[model samples]
Target: MLEKIFKWILTIVGFALGYAATEIAKNWGFINSIIGTSNIYRIGFISIAIILFGIIFYIVSPFIIKLIFKLTGFLESGIQKIPTNDIILSVLGLIIGLLIANLLITPFARFLAGNTILSIVGSTLTLVVNIVFATLGVNITLKKKDDLYNVFTFLRRFSKDKKSKADSKLGISQPKILDTSVIIDGRILDILKTGFLEGPIMIPSFVLEELRHIADSSDNLKRARGRRGLDILNLMQKELMLPIEVVERDFENIQEVDSKLLKLCQIYNGKIITNDFNLNKVAEVQGVPVLNINELANAVKPIVIPGEEMNIHIIKDGKEAGQGVAYLDDGTMIVVEGGRRHVGEVVDVVVTSVLQTAAGRMIFAKLKSAS
Candidate 1:
């Protein structure tokens, strides 16, 4: 059934081609002498041409279909490698180039009056001009695709200010891009309530996808974390003063979620909000702005200097013999030297040295009695 449809389609195409070929032949001296002022012979010749071409094409339709499929697959693969922005730029370039080519062809199009050879040459030149300009347009647009993209993005930012786009206006702050890890951490909700951070928080669709996958995870721990993240997002949307902007932009060619997040930061001029230490370091190295929730938590914790005395309950033994480990309310680890014997008891301790580390803040101290 499908084969017959394809054959007829190709046969129709062949008929059109035959008509086009006859029109071109009519421009030549040989064709005019053969069908000179004779309407009946012209119709007969055209019908014969159409029927002959249709039969030939119908017989070769299978090969044509195979070639078309091959060409389509090749084009699909090639186009898949190219970014959507580049394709738009290429099209824009082609239009501009064709326009220029048409303007340039105007003089020659009129000058070549009647001479067949000169007219053919002129037509060939016009074709060459259009092809050259079209190629140039595609090349130039592609070459400056980034600049053009930036310009368009800038325009869109203004045009879509009140829309679901980012609120990165002239005085407004860059949108804070939320990642899955930070969402799961859930401390950002408290921070949002404090109003210390700027407005216009954005959650990318890819990050949301990861969060959903985590929520749907088979493992209990992961599923809980994912559900907690979703819950936090829901709370933010319902309670927060600033409406959460869910960005649907995504990089199709990028496989890694982190890489896509970083790319999005660059594209939208947004800062990533994540508690993942590794991701924070990667963003720093890439010069992409990142707001680390862990960093913020550590910063807001009580600052204790050396010689400051504080009370803590010793919970466990530290690595060193007779060293005791305790935690402050904010979860800062306090190591009390020579207080291992006092484990499971609360005691006053004097800070000896405070150390700031990537993981968090750690304090070294001695038992107040020993001090």
Candidate 2:
């Protein structure tokens, strides 16, 4: 039904174009002579032209409809995905652009009054100018929106009282943005529950969308991981103590989630909470602060110095001969020398040395007797 209506509208447009073409053709002396000064012939010429154009448009309407549908779908999704603040800015930009175009076209409009061809040219130029200016307005407005927000935020800090001042001093004027890795790691929830982290935590809409995608994946492990992340997010929002500010911040230009996290950090002047080692390194290089859960876990782990004796089960053999691998309660790997034969049995070992790396802590130990 809509397609038919569109086709009819196109046919009417073609009819109008045919009549306008006739008016323009009158400027050509040859066209006047060929059609004669008779109204009958002139009307006949326009009638044929209108019929031809209307038929042509009717024939091509299906293809045009497809293109229109594609464009509409793309634009609809884009507009829906864009935050409301951005949409308001875009509309303001469009209005400003139209105002500028109206002012600039005023003089040109006068010159185009007496001539149909000139009027058409003037209208086309007006349309082009409107489009160019509107596009420029939108780009400029969106690009400067962050600066504008910062200005407002700065002013707000001055106007609000002591609590606001305290919040600013705490380096949380902007909420800490959570990354997919940290959310999936699930340790952040426990850390938040401890009441150490202050201020509201931000979860981007894109990260949640990514989790949903993962949750819908065919792979069992990925699906489970994604579901777990979602569940953790649910708990944080409903049951956790800290204020959860789930924001819809998104960067359309950035591809990887990690890169988006970095971009978001830059935008909000906020830190990232993540457990991803590579992301942590990248954030450091980018001058973005990061709270790495893995690093935090390692930092809080029980300190074990050399020559410390502890009982550990030799669950497996290490790479070298006569070495058995055990694990601390927190999953720290401990390699025990001369204990490979004791695999599947609990044994005592002395901590020979403790190694720490970006991944976590490792322990190299010798049997208590050998030590």
Candidate 3:
């Protein structure tokens, strides 16, 4: 019913335009004078032209609209790699700009009236101007709506990256997806405290649900950790003012949380933030980028070399006999040979070897000779 109404409106508009065009042609003596056209012939000709053009444009309009839809779909699909919130804000800006243009611009243009052709063309141009301003305003707003947190993040990475080369100075920043383990472990709190982590920290709604489940768990330890995670999240949002947005994004038909995480990371070209060793390894296998807290901590740890003597207190016994375990300031584990007797005491040990793994660094050492 609505379509038929639109068609009738179009038909009426077409007839008016066709009658107007014929009148103009006659007044201008373009065609009727050349053929000695009668009044009857002129009326018939004008009516036939009006009916044909209206029918053609109306018939082809649906196809035109479908083509436009396809083009918009292609553009949207391509930009899906960008954050959804940013896209929404951009559209909002576009609407606001169009509204302002309609109210302010069109009327002002109409106030500057002109002659027949000039007036018609000026009105047409005014409509075009409104559309152009709307589009421009939206695009400008979107391009400039830089999230402060995300910007700082890129700056830190960009500074580190500058050490490599002059040409590889910096580029576009990638999205940072916060994983459940990282949130629960609460190391991200400290990282954010330092104001180094850059880019918007996205907490997937599913991840938050998982955190809530952990908080409500039967196990006391898990419950405590879950609550702590929640506290840290609030602190980050309220105190630190970090943009911790929870997106209601999910991978339909996928049940496994890990699988969904990897899929989301791939979809957004985002890096996963997690302390899970297995997830890190799996991400590597799948070629998805990951920002492992363990890896970052390890990178910033003091370098321990073989044959270097260090003073460390033995905290506990290793699984093997006569072996004690110690930790560096950064929490990298060191296995000390023949140091079980030194438990609860500080001892100098000669570093024997260093093992670097996805989890962290491990140091092996033997007790130094007693002076």
Estimate the TM-score of every prediction: 0.66, 0.57, 0.52
For every model shown, the clashing-pair count is 0, 0, 2
Encode model 2's per-residue lDDT on 91-175: one tens digit a residue.
Answer: 8778888888889887897789679999999889888988898898888889888786566556644554675467678765556
Q: For model 1, which pairs clash? A: none
Task: Give the top-scoring candidate (TM-score).
Answer: 1
- For each candidate, what is the lDDT? 0.87, 0.85, 0.79
- Candidate 1 lDDT score relative to the true structure: 0.87
Write down the worst ten-residue block by lDDT for model 2. Answer: 156-165
lDDT of 3 by residue, 19-87 (tens): 777677777665866536577877687887788767776776566556766898999888876666566
**Candidate rank order under TM-score:** 1, 2, 3
Residue 17, candidate 1: C-alpha displacement in angstroms: 24
Off by over 4 Å in 2: 1-174
lDDT score at residue 50, model 3, on the 0-100 scale: 81
**Candidate 3 structure, TM-score to reference:** 0.52
Cα TM-score of candidate 2? 0.57
Worst 10 residues of 3 by lDDT: 160-169
